[model samples]
Target: MLTKSSQSVATIKAEDASKNCILVFDPDKTHAGKLNAILDFLGYDLLLAHSREELAHQLKKYPGLLTIIITGDLSETEQQDIVNIVAREAEHILPVVLYSVPAKNEQPVSLRYPPSWVAVKYPIAHQEFSSALDRVHAHFAHQQTEKGQRPAHLFRSLIGRSPAMQHIRHEIEQVGPTDATVLILGESGTGKEVVARNLHYHSRRRGKAFVPVNCGAIPRDLLESELFGHEKGAFTGALTAREGRFSLASGGTLFLDEIGEMPMDMQVKLLRVLEERTFERVGGSKTIKADVRIVAATNCNLEQMVADGTFREDLFYRLEVFPINLPPLRERVEDLPLLIAQLNDRMEYEKHFSVRFSPDAVSILSGYSWPGNVRELANLIERLGIKFPNGLVEVNDLPMKYRSGTGDGVSHDSQLDFFAEAAAAVRSQPFAVKTKPTVAQILANGQDMKSYVSEVEKNLISQALEETDGVIAHAAKLLGLRRTTLTEKMRKYGLQRPREGRATG
Candidate 1:
């Protein structure tokens, strides 16, 4: 039994606990394990509640845990107990997804359910599981955002918690207010455009439009007309007068992507516009005021281009006023978990689909150079959602370039329980005994303290070794045990590190 909270019931902040903390209860451990595997891979924090008391305790402890999943058959008494406990949680209301076998031909809807509870038939399909998650996510996003309870600048589109991401976000806030010519530098697919949009959203002109034009994508001959608009009969294809990117941006932002690829003639013209804030329409003498903030982005070396006499020096200096450099994905590998979580959330919320990458799979991805940057990572996430839709993606599941480690051409599918699976996946915790074994479940089964502690120790050491691919130093670091101590423990337990291609407990 757990000690109960004596603190008076009071209002709780939704952001009190970490986001996406899901608490689940199921009498059938196997079903719970399956959910654990799915939820962990999908990038959620899963906490198993052993009893009604434990469930209530966790809800009160983690107010950010807004979603509760209760599975298996609940007796009328047990159901009432859970309802009362949840109702007592006055601080934050929690949504419940209940899975129960329908007696005879009775439908799930025919049964009585508590407030904030929805029932799924006994045999829950992948689709229903995803739908349940969507409902909870939608409720949280819509309600919290509508009430203004959530921060205005949470910036779901710009996902990261790493220091690098924090610095970038801070930079956006600092430079977003200025009207200076901004140059965004990053490798292709590193989200230069995404940063530009963030700049626009935070600017005073957010209410206005944000126009993006790929300067390199447009033809060299027509680039002038595209930037400054053209009068009717200006060119062979110009049938009528039209607003160019400058006119369309009209007091907002003009994001010039691949600006390095602009012809030298256009660079000279662009520099004049930057210096004078005015440009004449092609084949028209009218000088239109360029009421737009210039935001140019490119993966090329503009400085080198200037030295090579390909790009104009004046234009290079003009666009370099406020440079924002985006670091490549490989440099900030720590942000992978958050990025994957955000991507998975997008897929689930939009398509009613969800998937997860095994800890080993994520570890393997971390080792890659990520030449394509975040775009490549996003594409891979989408591909996994399509390929293994609504399931787990193990190391072997990844494409050839990403495949490595002991998982190569190997399968450990039927080996460990979901408990070990999650602990291995977590980078923060080398081993997390999410829910400690209760005295009743252990002592009542004729277990003693000495044996229990040793057993638990052996299991954790085994799991850490397996997760680190039987590497002694790595496993020791994960277990927080010195190499000598871990080796001694292995000897005491009659255990030995498995071979490179295979691991066992």
Candidate 2:
């Protein structure tokens, strides 16, 4: 039991007791005592709940009054469940502080929010705890001014355990609190949207709306009006005065995904919005003040686009106030198992078959380069779940591409050599090695691009014919080129198929 101090460290004289109370939930009594001591020292009164059930009960009676401080060890799953529960039950304005202490000599970061509500490890000093509560209190006071509504969808506590994901989470934590416009750079399937959401949820304006617009998905003609709003009679299908995403998300965030695809003309207008924080609706003269944080994401290289003059340079700089680059899936292959487990749980919940990959299957997956990043891996796992309905996916249960030795990440020369050796050892075939120049070397040597490419193509075809006992189709597959393309290149290069004379040589 925590002994309360005689005098309050902080005081809020609320006529309604329910409107000004704090709730602290701790599974560990020791940590809970530390928190209580800090609150007592700060002159703030708090209600304590030792279990989830008890916390849920208090949340029901005084949904508006409660802000939460949760600490101690809990699993990732439990943390996420509580977040979902809080989102479901609490008043939109309520804030929750998730604090934790790591085990002795252990790092205390939780990957996903499920097992622990919102985690802060131990060794947190009294001032740190007090400052955290003060921030939360300020946020709730702002919520009260704004009508007891918090940005519900935006405050999601994203959870993941992979190192790549951990790095991303840290980046979000560092960047989210500020008003800086962030540019999230990642491949198509790398969950840029999730990062955007996390940024908005953790920002000062977290209680406001977070509107996400996919730039690539929307029609180019409509994107401008969609973002800036249109008047009642702006154009066809303009039924009434409509607010744009910028207006709807006023005092919050507007996430522009696939921003690389935005038109050059619109980019200029967007630049103005960022600069002036104001925009006029189509067919309307009134300049509305924009009060939204902008977070943009792109898979394309904006610098290249700037050099080409297809994208506005001014807009690029404005949008890139802060930038985060997500590592590709292949670069973070170590995270494959954890991602697979997450996918498995998600699929099971969706009534997709509960599937488990065998150790060999997992090994094969981890070894392969995920060109499509996390999205592709997720699709592959979901597919496996269905293909192996019984949940146990064996080595053979994988696709042929996965089973093949093509995932070795070997050089082209090594691959060709391996094939040549296998043919020579198994079938008494003679092997011929091709001397080829790399594209870079050819360019550096001042050879014409067309000629250089043709020379390389000829060498590959000649080598394929030499290695396959002049078998064109098999050699085509070995080189990962179509039979017709190989044949055409051979003719173009004036290289003949190995006939009787060539075979003898």
Candidate 3:
């Protein structure tokens, strides 16, 4: 539906998009349309700084901002605002601000650009500026890349109608175009890996490989070689040189699932690769460029793991740039019908047979708790298809556990009608009131880091114990801690329930 003015847009160098990204600030609305189309056609990462605040924010957010286009006959006030923001926040790293002009000699006046910035008349930039533009190849050489390819047939779209699913799709679409690291979080069978694949499918790296590595599945001793590859005779099993997930996923995406399961020493090496964007294979001195985008997923309580000294804090912050938390099926029961349809469709396509869930059967399934999440639902659908073939599944046909739900399945006590309204809540919002001090407040107060952390941990354990009525196992689960660990922390802090005392805790 988009019509290009000329093929000249395509004639530009293919790699220019990454290095020649532009930010347009056209307060007058004069040059937005033409430039918008040109940038789109040319595959440039175009962004708009509609307000002065946005100009500063975008500069710090996207290091790939190579060029800036500011339009309108700049009044003295507007020019000063632009100069102050761009100079302060943008770092003026090869800053080349092009001002839209009416004629060649007529300068867009009064905009006394900073000494570090190069201001040029637009629609006719100086020829020498092209050389300066060429230097932009290094713009994101140290930052990130957005080289992606989208192919339709390779993956299934996320299927759901819940608010949680809608938010997830929005996030995927927003960050999919850029090369930011994504961390998917959820319980087992909640489809963490599926989210990773969806991210890759929607990303610019769709044409590249989507290499997945389950850190927990691989032995700790071999995880390093599995990720960074190995040279011939690297170890006992290294009979020949082999490419690892990082090498295999070059110019693509490396999905590190169960990242929490990665050992501590290996975590150090992985951190180096991520920070340096270069890694040498095991037993090899040759350093290779890591052109792969990282997408990590883990069901483990990484925050709790970090608190317990099990996971790396720095590595946690690194991969957790943009986190996508998947809602478990029990929390989003309204999405069951849509998820069922998707799974049934898959079964029919693959096996040439299907089973349809009647309305009552769906209601029963919704009322029943799903401990295994979507993967459980998927397995159930496949089993039903095999049992009933092309037949309809009625309420009686469902498992006893589902049929045993509140009477007619949909009807329940007014106080406990979970199936009717559970999905309305966003997964990330905690039901309990959070009255803890923010990271900013803690940092600004200049408190001792160790003492502050211990006090906070003590407070959390106390709160959890209070909420669970001094039940140790229950409170431990609520705080995502091991029962033994929580008990030890309780002893360390001398946490005890009133009247019941330490023995109860």
Candidate 4:
């Protein structure tokens, strides 16, 4: 018989145990020794706990423990106590195996245990114990796989660890399985379509098609026909009957991007379809069932549009059943490091080369207000990858606007000082010519010097606005220009900031 003193004497500290270590609780020294020999022969690490107190201590010390194994004579109450401790402290549900013999005059050992726990007859054959251990190992392996699995829609996209992103992910998981209409609202380039795709992939309609149509991109006259099919001879170019996006996306999802840009007349028709779950072809009177989940996205404020009588209130309400607002890149600046790493990994995969950004480079990039959001960041990263495929990108390696923070709201004197600092940093490092052309090369390539200079000036001004987060006075100071002069230039270049909302980060 396994004695408590013998079992307790061999107790192993949970902190020193390996990740694959198993917690074995068996008070009987004989049974514990037998199981220990079996496990040790199999090259498994074991942590023996003789009592509830020891078990609790081991659990607290090793939150990353793999599984638990209990053998010998364990009362039902003791078993319950062990399970309670495992369930309460474990990061995830752990598989537990209980081996026990029937007591005198008692019924056969019951297999009754928690879903995560398995009970087996004690004094079992070595083969049976081996099989049980195999099952436990398999269960642990499966759990590890599940922990690492990403949502199908999240493959190669939608990367972030911020609270806002985490909340968005939770909302997607909650709403993706339903057939309700989802309205996604965010600024432009905020990956609204990505969210829609994620919803479709996670929903029951994943196997079917995912048809996306940008309402703003399509001509107003053809928008209706694009959404609903047209019959033969429906219009000037209707040579044959053709299925619309709704028909193409039947039994799946239809992502309506920039829904706010739809015309008022089209909005009424859309509202009717949403209400009835059916639509008629543009040139045909036959009503067709949509059978497609609607996911609408917009950068415009639909409520404000409704107040202005531009967007139909009924359609807005129908689309807003489950609204998900995506935060812009500037709002989640803390996630920049992860985003940069992911972006660079993608670049390396595609280009067969990689570049590491220096601390200063990262600082400059993170400090800027990403007005264009993730899309702009992706573009900038790709540009860098193309320019320097495999090299350390330092502060001076960054663009002038980024290095000097010319758009980040520093005073004129401060901006000048930063420029001096940037120039010194650049001078300290050896200059390396990039594959891209210089301004002199462009001039020699027969490009108009005046137009080229004007374009460069315009780009500088745009970067300034972006860095200053669209603060006109701050941008003017960064550019060392008067507010009126900056305003005039902004007007000349047709640069306008969108209406402000609640700032984050």
Ranking by lDDT: 1, 4, 3, 2
Q: Is candidate 1 or candidate 3 better by TM-score?
A: 1
Cα deviation of 290 in candidate 1 (Å)?
1.0
Error of 2 at 83 (Å): 27
For candidate 4, the TM-score is 0.53
Rank by TM-score, descending? Answer: 1, 4, 3, 2
Using lDDT as the measure, the top candidate is: 1
Q: Worst 10-residue stretch by lDDT in candidate 2?
A: 424-433
Whole-model lDDT values for every prediction: 0.69, 0.64, 0.67, 0.68
Weakest 10 consecutive residues of candidate 1 by summed lDDT: 1-10
| Candidate number with greatest TM-score | 1
Candidate 2 TM-score versus the reference: 0.52
TM-score (all chains, Cα) for each model: 0.61, 0.52, 0.53, 0.53
Question: Residue 118's C-alpha lDDT in candidate 1?
Answer: 58
User: What digit string (tens of lDDT, one per residue) describes model 1 on residues 1-505?
Assistant: 2211111123333353345557677666655655554554445656776687777777777666657777656776777677777778623444655555557888654344565665665455444555566566656655555676652223455666445687888988898998877899999998999999989988988888899999989999989988999999888989999879999999899999999999988998999999999999998999999999989999999999989998888888899998988887755655676687777766655565667765566666765667788888888998899998767777788988776422222212111222233333232321222354322233334443234446676898889887888888888777554577678778888887776555332
Instruction: Residues 416-493, candidate 4: write the lDDT tens digits.
Output: 222222222222222121443322334344443234445665788888878878888877877766587678777877
RMSD (Å) per prediction:
11.9, 20.3, 19.8, 20.3
How much RMSD separates candidate 1 from the native structure? Answer: 11.9
TM-score of 1: 0.61
